[model samples]
Each structure stands twice: as structure tokens, then as C-alpha cells.
Target: MNLSDLRQDDLGLGIGLRTVHFGHILENWPDIDWFEILSENFMHTGGRPMYILDQVAERYPIVMHGVSMNIGSKDPLDLEYMQELKVLRNRCKARFVSDHICWTGVDGTNLHDLLPIPYTEEALKVMAEKVKQVQDILEAPLTLENPSTYLEFAHSEMSEPEFLRQLANETGCGFLMDVNNVFVCASNHGFDAKEYLRQVPWDQVLQFHLAGHSTFETHKLDTHDGPVCDEVWELYRLAHELSGGRSTLMEWDADIPDFDAVHGEALKAREYRQSMSSTSSSLEND
Candidate 1:
């Protein structure tokens, strides 16, 4: 994958479009670069949320990130859901559509969570086929985010980054690299976060996600509730150096804060991005 394959613009420094800040967004229209809409939120509704989304989309560039694609599931693909997703994409004029690289549910039940998939070849083939089918329906590259897992499958054949690389190559799909998820999973699963960054297929990465997570005695939960931690910031630094940066977004889904607070947190990613840019320039000059 090359830069030419990613036709979308890199809309820098965004926050998830959450309802807690809807009034602030519409009234103030803060100086953020873009907003990532949870695609499902606007999918089945024609209510006030949709109205506000219309206003926001008109003002700033929009991207669609969904949780319910169920790309790795054994269940049949939901054609009606895909059609509705595309409708929402067109309605908002989203620059691109993204979902997690995990399955949501199986056997006709909506689990409503991003469930992990094993990293075996069979699982990879299933996900790749599903991803291709989805892209064909949406008529665009379907970007997938790496999920933070609490456990690894025993029969796995590869590392997470390698699996993601294969999936991207096989399906011609894009990636939403979540730096914090890498940190969380690395710490929980005992892997080098920097090594994970090194192995990522940066060329396929279309956007980046930075968020905060909660730490338990035994493991970490990907609860995007507060400011990004320092370790994740350093990992973000590594990722920036590798990918040369991409459209980065901050996610704060739990214990939500005010619009300004969340936007300010999102802006923190800029420090690493800018500093990396300067360092790269200095090296080039040397």
C-alpha cells in the first residue's frame, strides 16, 4: 500500500462527536480540524442528533467510525445495515468509513462489544473476505481498528500487527491505528509496544487514535474516559516517527467531559506530531 491508495485527506486533530458536547459544537463551533461520528449513532435515527450532525458536517470534515460491522463474525453479513451505513455516509458526506477489526456478535445476537478474533490464517481469511464484501457494498476502503484484547488465542499463528498487515494487503483495506490500544495490549500481553509500532504497515494506516484506558490489578481496560497517559504519548511519538503522522483523533467515550476539555485533550497529540516533524527535518538537514 502506498500514499496514493489512501485518497482521503488527512484531517488533523479531531475528537469523537459525542452528545455531551453537541450544544457546544453547534453554538461555538470550536476550532477543531474534524469530527469522527460514531456511524451507528446516526444510522437509525432522524432525530435531533442527526440534525446536529448535519450542522457539524456542513462546518467541518466528517469521518464515520462504527462498532457493529461484525467483520470477524461467523454470522451472515447484514446487508440492510451496510445499506444504512452507506446512506449515513452519504448523508453526512463522510470522508471515509471505519470499524473495529473484531467481531461484535454471532448467531443473530448483537453482542454490542468489540470482541477479539484469533490471529490464525483461517480467521484472517474470514475477516478479509468479509472486509472485501463490505468495501464492495460501501464503494470505499473499509478501515479497521485494532482491538485491545485481554487474552490471546492459543492457536494464533501471528502477532497483532502482522495480522493487521496481512488483512490490509489481502483486502486493500485501510487501518485506524490506535496507539493507546497498542500500549494497553502490550502491557497486558507482555509485548514491546515499540516493536508493535515498528511492525505496523504504516502505508495502510489512514488515521490514528489516541485515548486513555483504565488499569486493573491484572489487566487494562480500553475505557476511553480521561486524558491520554504519558506512556501512550511516548508510543504516539514512536508511531508518528514511523508513519510520518496521519489524521489523529482522540477518543473520550466514558465519564465524558465538556467540549473544551475533550478538545484540549485531543490537541495534546499535536505536541508529539510537531516535535517529530522538527526532529525529522533536523535529521534531513544533517
Candidate 2:
């Protein structure tokens, strides 16, 4: 896959459009490149969230990111949910629709968490087919984010990147590269983070997610509640250099501070991109 074949535009740095900052966003109209909406939040709503979204959609390029696609679930695809997602995508004119690579629940139960799937060939075929079905219904590529996993399935046949690479190849889907998750998973699972980044199919990367994670005695949790750590920032720098830059987003879902604070964190990615660009130019000249 050539890098130029990426579907979405390089939309610059943006933040997840949260209700906490709605007033500030509507009033100040801060200098942000785009906004990513949590798709389920607006799917069944006709209230203030939808109202704010309508207003924001008019001003910025919005992308729909969801947590409930459940692409890797054993159960069949959720048709009603897919229809609602289509409506929302059209309503907001979202550049693309995305969700986690893992399943959220099974057996008609909603777990409300991004649960990792085993990387076996059987699971791969199932997920790739489900992704294709989702794309067919939405009439667009379904970009998927890598999940922060706590444990690994011993029965897995392939590595994480290998599974994603083949899935993208089979379904022509896009990827939301979460650098923080990669770092957290690497630290937990004892793999080289840089090698994981190298294995990613960069051409299929549509967006970059940089968020803060909480470290416990055992493992790191993707809490998205604070500033991005320095190691994650370095991983973001590497991702920028690898993918030739993509639309970067900062997520602060929990304990989110004021609007300026979140946007300030998001702006750091812009600085990283600029620095990488300058260094690349200098190297080229040298």
C-alpha cells in the first residue's frame, strides 16, 4: 500500500469533541484543525450533544470514532447500529468512521470496554469479513484503533501487527494508530515498541491518537485522564516520521481539565510534527 493511497486528509491536530469544552469551543472557536466525535454519544440523541455537534460540524472537519463496533465479536454484526452510524456519518459529514480493533462484548451483552481478540487465522477471517460488511453498509472504509491489551491469548497464531496488516489487506480498511497503546502494550508484554511501530502498515494509517495512561504495579492502563507522557510523545514522533504525518488527535476522556488544557496538550503534537519536518529537511540538505 502506497502512503498516498490514504483516504482521509492530513487534518492537522485536533481533540476529541467533549461536552466539557462545548461552551469554550462554541464561544471562542479555538484554532483547532478538526474534532473527533464519539459516535455512540450522538447516535440516539436529539438533545444538546447533537445540537452542539451540529454547530461544531458546520465549523470543523469532524471524524466519527466509536467504541462499540465490536468487529471481532463472535456474534453477528449489529445492523441497527450500523444504520445509525451511517446516518450520523452523513449528518456530520465525517471524513471517516473508526472504532477499536477489539470486540466490546458478546452474547448480546455490552461490556463497554475494548476487549482484545485472539490473533488466530480464524479470528482474522471473521474480523476482516465483518469489517467489510461494516464498510459496505457505511459506504466507507472503517478505520480501527489498536487496543491496549492486558493479556494475550495463548492460542493466537499471528502477531498484532501481522493480524492488522492482513486485515487491512483483506478489507481495505484504515487504521487509527494509537501510539500510547503501543507503548503501554509493549511495556506490559515485553516487546520492542519501535519494532511494533516498524511492523505497522503505515500506508493504511488514517489518524494518530496520543493519550495519557495510568501506571500501576503490574501494567499501564489507558485512562486518557492526564497529559501525554514523554515516551508516548517520542513514539508519536516516530509515527510521524514513519507515516509522513497524518491527522493527529489528543484524547483526554477522564478527569479532563479545561478546554485550554486539552487543546494545549493536543498542540504539542503539532510541535512534534514541525520539529520532525525541520529535521528531515536538514538531513535531506546534508
Best by lDDT: 2
lDDT of 1 by residue, 108-173 (tens): 899999988999999999999999899888888898998888889899999999999899889889
Runs of candidate 2 with Cα error greater than 4 angstroms are 1-8, 283-286
Candidate no. 2 TM-score: 0.96
lDDT (C-alpha, whole model) for all candidates: 0.90, 0.92
Task: For model 2, name the residue pairs that clash.
Answer: none
Backbone clash count, each prediction separately:
0, 0
- Which digits, one per residue and each the tens of the lDDT, describe model 2 over residues 227-281? 9999999989888999888999999999999999998999988788999889989
